[model samples]
Target: MSGRIPRQFIDDLLVRVDIVDLIDSHVPLKKTGSNFVARCPFHTEKTPSFSVSRGKQMYHCFGCGASGNAISFLMDYSHLGFVEAVEDLAAFVGVDVPREIGGDFSASDKEDFTRLYAVLEDVAAFYVDQLRTGDGRIAVDYLKARGVSGEVARDFGLGYAPQAWDVLLGRFERDALIDAGMLVVREDGKVYDRFRGRLMFPIRDKRKRVIGFGGRVLDDSLPKYLNSPETAIFSKGKELYGLCELLQKKSRPERILIVEGYMDVIALAQYGVANVVATLGTATSKTQIDMLFRYASELVFCFDGDNAGRQAAWKAVDAALSCLRDGRQIKIMLLPQGHDPDSLIRDEGKAGFEQRIEQAQVLSDYFFDFLAGPLNLSSIEGRSQLMTAARPQVEKIPPGYFKDMMWRRLRELAGSRVVELPEKPSTLNRQFQGKVGKAKTQRPSLGRRVLALLIQRPELAQVLAQRHLSLEGLKFAGQELLEDVLRRIALEKPENGAILLEAYRGSSYEKTVNALAGVELDIPEGGEEAEFFGAVIQLLKQSRQEKLTELLAKEGREGLNAEEKQVLRALLRERL
Candidate 1:
């Protein structure tokens, strides 16, 4: 609990948890050939683009470019953080995660957050208790008037704060409540409840643990929303209201709606629209947007159709551009004047509200439209102005089809004044243009093939060591990585690809090793050993040829030493 999870533990955990079994339990994989296949859970695809390799203990999505080991799969599929995902996997395999001596977490850091989470949970329970007790009827009646049902209220853990200042102060420890952001200490040496006479919305993380609270006054009051102060466990910019509830309703929603307030989220959910989350009194951050995309592919930011709403939506766009990928989408939906999501949902009903969602302007369209505000695009000067304003933001988009299409749209809008952009990289199309029609005649280099084969079946390392050959002087692009893999395989004797790659995690070779783990080698089944030895022999011979040529050149320049002469003689006698 004090330090990072030991790498050895993680490697062992990967060995215990079979990738095929783990993914099958979640995604219902079908055996297509040697590996299992499923429709990718990360994106919407008709074809089964997701593959789980039993031999490698890895999953890769051909359509969306999602690939990783078991820990990564949980992080994406369950929306859990890294530690949480590791813990989940460990629990599945019935092992406890061990911590190293020096890691990101200290003992106090671990204990403090544990206590903070517990105190927050207690505080939330106390507030929820207040909702059902005396004077709770006002809060309950307020919710009823807003058409919030009992079930939805309970589902979201809606609560109430009594008007008294000492309610929570007297119940929980002073220091713990203050640390939890429940009790505030003023400069005058007075402590009071942070939320009073308000409806409380407990903000929980993806793990469904309360981290903070958002309090809304029942009647019209200054500062209509008073949120929990930034604490160790809570950052308003990184948290979203109703997200845990949304995930509970559907583990993976087709689309997620973003609103401005807690009531909007609650009201929408009351109207049978369950896939909505609200920004907690701050502009949406990239962290929140990334978190949202983990649960849904599409996001609709629903704001009031006022100048302020447009301003907020624009800020969201600025935050979202960098997060755009091939399959992800962001849309902006501005409600009618004088109405927010709460009032609009009640007035228009669920069908009408969802219709607005479907009609929301896509981010690309909204982005250009927002940039073209009051600008005469027909005029050269105005088009030039648009190009200048949009170039930097457009470049923030990740390289993919989405970025390419956005560039195309910008060019069409800025026709004569288009700024020359870099030529699109050829690799951008590789994700979409998969190996559907390509012939299998192409093969990677011998070194690369050996690396791929070793990754797919780490036991091949033992087979390789049996040859009693050493690649001590071989020089190639991935020579160092190849040496490292063989060395790790010898030391740890990893049972599969996951355990073998775990040693390379967080190292410079992680991406290369993982890519090799997922590589589709074209060698015939049961021919891995022959191919492996054949490649090894060729590389050794190639290396010897280079050395022989070097020694002969050195002899012509200066006579060779005894060892060098013997090496040259041995190399000359061997068949090329």
Candidate 2:
């Protein structure tokens, strides 16, 4: 709502929302000593790999390389946008999110979203009513024939689009419907209903606001299913149908089932198998996978047995690779030929369906089998081709025992361990590696070390500032940020990292602040004050020596004026 969330409010919010309690509410953590432990929600693993530090108000997962503070955890775990996560954390702690509106800021962006939600709600109700009308009777009959019940249909808010092109034009504003993706306007300037003579399923978000729609024709059609185009309110890739209901379930689900369509989701729910969601006219995307993982530890992707289905499953496998870590599991289940979940559920019923789910192939198993399916393992050339094709995809997965085991299995199948399969870090870990860099385990640079110490023990800023350090002369990668942080602490005197973090809360420096706050320093808790000043003094001495060298060069080459000569004298006069 403004330039940024006030630093004081964020600091206060952090105090109110304990990081442990906040993560535990979503992930169910067990206390062990001073920290809490849980399986990393970001990855698939059998043993717990996630740890939360009580002292630092931070959490890091050893298995998956996920690490962040309370707000970061909320964003990752709850799939909230940064601002949304901040607001959610504040709400969790019973505080309101405070905003600072600069002269250029306005509340219209937030207000526009609120209006869009209202428009979607009205469109959803209109669709629901259309299902019961005379023209919608055909759609009602179609659902009845498919074994969908009135109760279940109403629960899902199933609707019907009348055969007429402009049925909604008289009832609702055309522009609103178009913006909501319910109406289509062609280049020739003709406006008509986007979905016609079809059964409609409203797709809602986690907040239960209708964002989009999925529709299936009542009669035989070339393209059987149609979905709402991307709109201001909807992103096809990020959202899943029936996710709202999945989140609202009273009992925790052991795993989540992702299927192909909206009807598949509703039909499964009708059969009392409710831990299901459907991707909206798209292959499973990484964004959707992350959001789904928030509610369950395992993901079972249901695909058809055909080649197309296998292709889709592989896309999911690829998308899920960066997300896979210890404590999270991904499985692939292919329905029998000619059977989708909709038809299979009708034929096999719940008991038989459960058996098939139990038989779902684990990611490693499916991956190997899929790769081997097109190869002749008995031939050396075939085995070599198989290995070449698979190694790239296998390496995409995070470094773990699972990856190692998969490589071992592949080698065994190829009839050779002659060439060793060296383990590589996962793509996810590579990304995190880029953030922390090689410097994470190595000794930090002088500037970084000083900043880390100042962040951890903000009082060090006062000592450095009291010396009236010449920040302009400092040549470092983060000189400006370090100087700004020191200035804030020296002037405003934010007592700790918690309050210091507030200055960075909604700014570009937030990432740097988080990185510094989480980084481990070798200094003992009681010794940071000395370490801070010591690093700064060393930096100052280095800078003064460099200045003296430069001045000597200038006097030798270009010559120095009286003022420059005075500066050179001062540098020469300084002692270490």
Candidate 3:
């Protein structure tokens, strides 16, 4: 694989994958006027505050500060790296991601990893074919005995890898299988299939492309289930077992059920409760949580009713703090002792299993419950300890009613203890993002205004440049960033916010671009262009003042040269 992914692949992938189509596949959106609207998945909320623009091909949460384009959304939601997200997007849109390998392109270097994806799919088909062979009866009986109907088995892409050491070697190239994660090679040069003697589950991305596999041994084994190692297309921490099928449901599922095992997810599907997914031999990751939020507003984690399980749930609580936006719900369902989703659903059926879901503890209740478990909240020292532990987590949440509510709950737990709350963090670093739109700071500075205008109407960059304008001598806080933008604008001349944002992907000013791109400025409706020019004029005025200051400082420090004195006199002759 090439080390550096070309920018052209990213741009092409963005064009092929529409932002609305990508986000709506996860978050159920309703057509609202010209755009789509859904409750923001970033924070907890009661109404729709998230909006997707088909025109701009971007999304923004009016409630919390979360905002991005299609590629960024996948990175944040799926917890994928930049290259991984690009590959996944390209696969979704049926394009080949051309990676630029060392200098010029050769035929081998230009080959996209799509071929590896194809190999995995073929391997999945072979495993499914194996399940029907005479030697595969044990695997078939195992599924049938576990109550997996043939239709459900087919629905989940379940299969069985043959017990023979060289079963796959005869039909496929060993190196291709290795790259696709279907085979393992030893240092001694011995190579074998990775899933021999095991029932197979093909792990796919949201696009329904088979990327890797998970296998469970039928006999007594040290490790009961083994998943494919991370390949170009698969990251175990980022995928959920049944989400691809769950997303295809007609009525969007209101809450997603997260469990620990593949059978747990498949078993739930068998019982007609299909909103469940399984993490692949890992903890509930932040990417997993964020991805779950894309499909539903609420998530209920099904764990065993044991101390160990409670500890795991608490870990989930800690991981979820950073991603918890207002309007989203997270809960913990500790199943009765000695019962897992698979066994419990088999014993009590779907209704009984859902009863436990209904009774699961809300995140806030669990948050305090878990923290207060070791500390005595009744004592003053214990209260101080509790506050000390909870303050940092409370501050991490995005500004919303949910965060405000958590703070109040913490204060209530502290009884007469003084806890200082930080000032409200806004979506756009100002109070105007709140429902009241009250201005909490002074007027937007010349630097800030120039950034706002360029972000809102990106084409204005070309107009500003055509007029022979630049940041020049402006020395405000974001002046350096403004100059960078101006240079890229003059060189690349991107047309929209999405393209403009892409221009600064790995630049130091990425966060600033993200913040500026998503913010809806308070400029007057009809006079956007005029307002931008006006801001530019103010910025230039500040640049002139900055120049004047520099000249005066130079003269103060040492006697000015004759040319400097002439320039100073000319500048001072002009009226302020």
Candidate 4:
């Protein structure tokens, strides 16, 4: 694991895990002509803007700017690092991920990840063994009482931590537990267990490695739930509980059910609701929502009818709205008074639960109706109040038809009084100001735009190279992306955008390549080519002239610095 995994291993893994099969598990791709089409999972929209090319083993979401290979998709969707994604794909195909491959692979991060994985595996096993015997029976009984079945419990790798603080501390090396975020050291340098006497719910990465844990207290305790602190392998914002199993099963659950606690997930799963996961006792994050897009196109956020749960659902809805794109959808489901998914499933059975799920409303619809319910729309002052409250929320939406829809709904709900709504200040102005301030502060030299022109037209590459245009000449900060393209062109001799992009596969510039490929290119012909070059030269001359004028005005005759004076004289001499 210390050495870099070989390129051949990655290639073999990709071959084993068919791109079409892997992508289909997350996206409901329907046959559209020769390729498959689904709503882009990356952005919000009603129409499909994402497509998969099986022949090329790639996917591109035209809506929210997500485009990548199968490996990248797994990494993005599952929140697995590159190595983990590769290893998982290899294991899925029943192939071994070799610890060492003969190559000069340069990613220290990958090495760190491998080590962390080994440590986490050891920790998960320890917890599982503890749950099988000893004080872990308390945890087992607790789950059973909550309506979690043995099969579901086994499926999720649920376990328990003993009452003793050092139960896990004694089993593993001190540094290992600390590194894995399983222990907290006090001021006296004595390390105590992070999760004691609680049912252990292993939070796994998409590759099926338990990266962290969510612990549920069996007894009536303050806090009731505790989760693994953030670690190199786990970020609460990025990982979801059941994604690994869902990905492997390749089942497109019609709808995804999001709950608040581990027991909620286990109980729902016990009742054959396989597409359920808990948020580890925190608010839903964008990463979690993005991960869900990989599996279910629609997500139903189920919470209790209590005020706290309703508030939680509101937050979840807001988060979901930000992450939604063309094909994906989200809904809010409030359980009956004083009931959560766990309690409802227990009292009324799976049928009762499914019936309520069927009635879940789309988030936007729910939000509008919920807001309307409390406010009186008939009164002018009430409408004004509603607009005042809703405008801020509307402004938070990224510019799109979704924003328009919200405004339209407001108009319908408030009628002519919609004008009373506050107008959002221009974000573009804010963004421009930010960019201008940054430019003034950094004053980064512009990278050569000439290289971009050359990459777009391979025929121009030789001309630019002949002119001694290297990446250093390109003063632009993002010139690295262009340099990557030029390097690809030099080595691959790509005749077209598609070929050029293919040559960049598995390279760091894959996303850049995809973006470049998406750009429409124009290759001038005959006189037009000459005219284009002439226009470019003229623009350069004009730019130089403008700079000289500015310098002359600012510094005058005696105010000119030596280097500037020399340059000015040279330019004057050239013009003369």
RMSD of each: 5.6, 9.1, 7.4, 11.2
Q: Give TM per candidate.
A: 0.81, 0.67, 0.70, 0.63
Candidate 3 lowest-lDDT run of ten: 431-440
Per-residue CA lDDT of model 3 for 1-576, tens digit only, reads 436668766765666678899889878999987779999876679999888877667787766757678888887666456776887788778876675656544556434366787778888898899889976889999999998999999998899988888889889878788888777898998988887889998887776789788899999985899999998768888888888888766234789999989998888999999898898988889988887886678999888889888888988888888888987999999988999899998899889888889988999999998887789887989998988898888887877888888888899998854665557664432322222221313355556667867864677876666777665545666666676777777787565567677777787667667666665655555576777888888877776777777899999998799988986786678534
Which candidate tops TM-score?
A: 1
Worst 10 residues of 1 by lDDT: 428-437
Steric clash count of candidate 1:
0
Please provide, for model 1 over 109-155, each residue's C-alpha lDDT reduced to its tens digit, 9 standing for 90 to 100. Answer: 76788899998899889988998898888999999887888998999
User: What is the alpha-carbon lDDT for the whole of candidate 1?
Assistant: 0.83
Model 3 clash pairs? 42-325, 43-325, 43-326, 43-327, 44-325, 44-326, 44-327, 44-328, 45-326, 45-327
Candidate 2 on 111-203: residue-level lDDT in tens?
566666777788778878987778888888888887889988887888887788898888876777777777888899899888888888888
RMSD of 3: 7.4
What value of lDDT does candidate 3 attain over all alpha carbons? 0.78
Query: Which regions of candidate 4 fall more than 4 Å away from where they truly are?
Result: 1-112, 417-499, 502-576
lDDT of each: 0.83, 0.78, 0.78, 0.68
Ranking by lDDT: 1, 3, 2, 4
